[model samples]
Target: MDQVALLQISSALLLNVGFIWLVGSWFARRWLGSSGVKRNDVEPALRKLDLVAAGVSAVASVVALYAATAVMGGISLQEAGPMFWMMLSTTHYGHIGCLTILAMMILFAIRVRGGTSGASDTASLLTIVAFAITRASMGHAGENGILSVSLAAEVVHFFSIGLWTGAVIVSAYFVLTPQRVATLALAVTDRYLNVMSRGVMLAVILIIGTGLYNAWHRIGTVEQLTRSSYGLTLLVKIALVACAIGLGGYNKFFGLPAAGRSARGVAVVRRVLQIESVLLLGALAAAAILTSQQPPTAI
Candidate 1:
């Protein structure tokens, strides 16, 4: 891939990871606290991590905005400088890009002004949702207008991915650590796992539904799926997603039940979650590459 493609992938990966982290943190605190875990034990560390993720996401949004401009103008980064302002001021893509950046900035501000208060949490969630919507509005979906079914499907798809992948990432690397799991009461651990299992199942259902709509809308035929660059990348993405889902299924059906029984089970489940997350990340990379290609239907 070229520099622009690489930049797009980096920006997409960073933004998605950051968004997932924030969402996962939010869910972890809420679910764990509801399950009778002590919020004070985990809140401070999670808050700090959330802020860092927000900052990285904000930077990624800026990078994405510039990358979009450069791509639109068909110019190298340096040469694109002069046309940047023109693109920003005049194009629909630029308008949506600016809105996306604004949403991320707002989310960052909310995270920085940290409080465990319900109002603060609600603001953070709303801002992140707005960020997702604006980001979704910037690509093929945006071409159909804000009120279109395409845009709605894309938004739903984005959120489903966030819920599933983000939860796995946060659970594996942050929340379900050996130390933390050992500290939690058995009841609390079981409740948290149950809630997460249900949530992941719901997310997977939505992901499949929206994913099919998106693929059909973009590719339209089996021939395009095999012949076009965008279609082929999409097939790879679908395969990765299928693999991730398979792992998630194992965790939900078997690993989670085992986890509810013992601490060792939790460790095993966390390892599987980590593997699942890697697959999900690969899917995200494939998605980034898909965005850089022209969809077969667009031809």
Candidate 2:
């Protein structure tokens, strides 16, 4: 991919980390709220995750703002600042996105300082959803004739991906840390696995359905699959997705039930989750490449 493509892709992946943080933190608190574990235990874990997530989100917003200008203006990133400022001051979409970023920064501050409430969390969630929606509206989803339907499908796809990846991220934090032994009690971990199993299954279905719907319209025909770069990259992405799904299915069916039975078992599951994350990252990169290239119909 070219530098601009790389910037867009990187910005997208980085942006995802923000959404994932919200999902992860929310789940950790909600799931453990009723457990015997002290609320102190659960809340602290979330805040720790929040500190890292806030930093990531802040950096990503800055990068995306710069990258958006570069991509749209077809200018070197360093030269895109003036254009970025102009859009921030003039365009509806640009201003809205910037405002969301500003709000999220404030929310992140409250989160890090341990002052976040359900209301703040809800606001942040909505802001991220808005951000994701704006992204969809400006991209391939809104390009075709099915603007309304495509936009809805894109929302489902992005949120589903965010939810699934977010849970995995939290799991990684708890499982891979040196303090795993104390991070969450065994019962709590088991409950988390149970919830994740159901949540991820639903997300997978949504992601697959919306992905195919979008692709059918964009790819247009089987002949184009072999004739265009977009189609080829999409095929590769599909393979990567299948790999990720297979790994997740294995974890859900075979590994999860066995998790927390022993320290060794938990460690094994942790390793599997980390690998699944890597597979997803590969898929995300392929998706970015596919997005940057023209669709087969256009090609």
Instruction: Give the 10-residue window scoring lowest on summed lDDT in candidate 2.
Output: 28-37
Candidate 1 pairs with clashing backbones:
none
lDDT (0-100) at residue 234 of candidate 2? Answer: 89
Name the top TM-score candidate.
Answer: 1
Residue 281, model 2: lDDT of 69
C-alpha-based local distance difference test score of model 2: 0.72
Q: What is the TM-score of each candidate against the true structure?
A: 0.97, 0.86
Report every candidate's CA lDDT.
Answer: 0.86, 0.72
> Candidate 1, overall lDDT?
0.86
Candidate 1 C-alpha lDDT tens digits along 1-299:
78887887789889888888887788888888888988888988888888888888888977877777778878788777788778878988888778877877787787677777889889888987888898888878878998999999999999888888888898888888888887888778889888987888898999999999998999999999999988889989999999998998898889988988888888889999999999999998888777778898898
Off by over 4 Å in 2: 34-36, 143-147, 175-178, 182-184
